[model samples]
Target: MGNQTSVNRALTLINEGILSGVDSITLEQLAEKLGITSRYLRELFKTYVGASPKQYALYQQLMFAKQLLHQTTMPITEVAFAAGFNSVRRFNEAFAQELKLTPSAIRKQHAAGSMKVQANSINLKLSYRPPFNWAHMRAFYQLRAVDEMEWLGDNSYGRTITLGKVRGYFTAVHNSEQSCFDINIVFTDTDGLLQLKRIVSHIRRLLDLDADLIEVEARLSLLGNALPKINTGVRIPGVWSTFEAGCRAILGQQVSVEQAVKLLKLLTAHYGERVTVGGQEVLFFPSAEAISKAELTELKMPGLRKSALRALAVFVSECPDSDVEQWLKIKGIGPWTVNYVRLRGLSAPDCLLADDLVVKNQVLANISSDPQESELIDIIHAKDKAAIKSYYLEKSQLIGQAISPWGSYLTFQLWSQQ
Candidate 1:
């Protein structure tokens, strides 16, 4: 088998390429991007992913094309290009060979007429497993949402988005009856059509629509009674990108969520791009270049934090593909900040934010009710940062092991208690 780290790194890059609508990426190009040989990548995929790199990419592209054919009224040629096929003939041949039916047959069976399409937008349904606590998810976004950048309605949530050079907005309405989100996407630029697959992938990550909560809750149940009954439908609500999540984490330090939201609003107002989509004015979260270049005097936070924010932006701006571990080298960024980025930014399944204050309090509350232990908690609270970090680290190791691979869910469950 290939080195585990290299194998994982390769897979992540491949998936990222697929999501970003780079349909034309050859296996050689993918290998070159990872600085590995194509033979090594093929071996890695065979051992871990059960297919060659080319086969996997083709499968994903075909699936995306199938979804578009079934869901949208776009012409077959458009669907072919949007899903990354070079020509309509190749798309049809692959569709026939893989599924034993043409795209037209699948579309006719599914019938796209059921979906509503607006003047400048396309509507698509994103599916997820049932027992989703959408109310909880909605409340989470509603609380931290920034004006102009995000909005929440009675049964829907909408936000502005920036994907590469394309800027637009989308609204995802909760369809509990259908166990899906009916999303309407409006792009200011026509490149949105070409980027349809990538946009859908981002929305899936942003809403966490593909998580298997049944298995997650089953494993988290191993934590026993330490947490309140595992909340059903609890999933890690993710941000649009890791850089955005890192910035939010840095700004959120030592402040309430409300205060953090205020800071985020100020940061957005100053650095984010402004665009009008479908007659609504929206702001795209500032890019790393924007944040790295500005002085950020508008933010009223401590000087160290503003410095940290700019440092992170500069790092991301320069090294867009670097690992999150590299962030620890920055001055103000720490374990909590990095893990927060992993949990919410990347939607990583195994991230345990043992260093978060709220997570620490919840864990402490669950493990003990004794007055002496409470006094110890008080003492730890009064002690230096090192002491507090040590205490939580030791305590978390006990439960953190039992909840392997689902620590992010456990973190959210603990947060839901407050």
Candidate 2:
């Protein structure tokens, strides 16, 4: 990598470290991890991200502390330590500086409107821009919901989650009245407040909490019948870990969604970590390192696909970014899987599955349709499948560029039509 690219990569890594609550790591240790001098790392962040890494880390921790105070009834001291503060005094000073309010007062203000909760559970709320299409989001996840670890029912989505070695489960129900999700979390311990922070962050991404729907709609609306109008909030559903999502994309290649989900379930059953809570069994998807070290011959998959899965796991173990060129180096991976992983896993806003079968079909139809649809079929049959896909991919690139950053949402809308 070029020096500037390396600096950008390090900055991205540092941002993730901060968000993941790496408050305990010393500056020297972090600099060593990034293979840069501490002084240079400080300069890069000051130039790009507008704050020192330490200041950013402190702000993230304090934000989590603020959320805990507003949502949970945990004691102030426990909240302090859980937010990575060494003492309640330090937490108080930081909290006062950031929000201009004491933790106790914040809790008191939230208590009046808080939901009734059991002793061991935490109740919180997740917000998104309005006009959300709950049905579309639920259907997308429900189609591939794993057997034991995840499920979508009625209007709510629930799943078992694992952070490091800590295991917990949470459910989110749409509260149309409040324009938010009423999230209920039941974990093994009340002291797992740090785990709660990680869980909340992942949940926000999973449901695309940070998306600006109004802006997306405005940009997309300019395309003018280029994409069907979605009256509600449509978002690209994200996974907790990019590794798992990449593996899924590999498994999904050239297979029906049902078949791919079936293989994933079997893979989980065979190699995933097993845990039980309240008589219900759940499995954490196997990690990249674990899969990279495992024997792939035991699985009933094609040899090329097995190789692809293992190669992907190994690549991810070494480098965590969603590098499509690196991914295409795998044996069975292609543009479709690479872009699918980018759109869903890394939360890349501009990605489009241009090579997707349904997307190609839709783009071809949009380009030319005839009376009785017979001419379209004849034209489709006249060309080789590769030629047709290449033709549409070129056209889709133009359409995708026109839409710019909301291409992922447009991709989802096209898929929903099928």
lDDT of 1 by residue, 32-144 (tens): 76678989888988988898877777787888888877788777887888787777888899888887989888888877464644546888888999878988999999999
Pairing residues by index, what is the TM-score of model 2? 0.82
Show model 1 residue runs off by greater than 4 Å.
Answer: 1-44, 112-119, 370-391
lDDT of 2 by residue, 301-330 (tens): 788898889898888878854455578877
Clashes of each: 0, 1
TM-score to true structure, per model: 0.89, 0.82
What lDDT is reached at residue 234 by model 2?
83
Q: What is every candidate's alpha-carbon RMSD to the true fold?
A: 3.4, 4.5
Give the clashing pairs for model 2.
131-233
Give the runs in model 2 whose Cα sits over 4 Å from its true position: 1-60, 84-86, 115-120, 189-191, 293-300, 315-325, 369-391
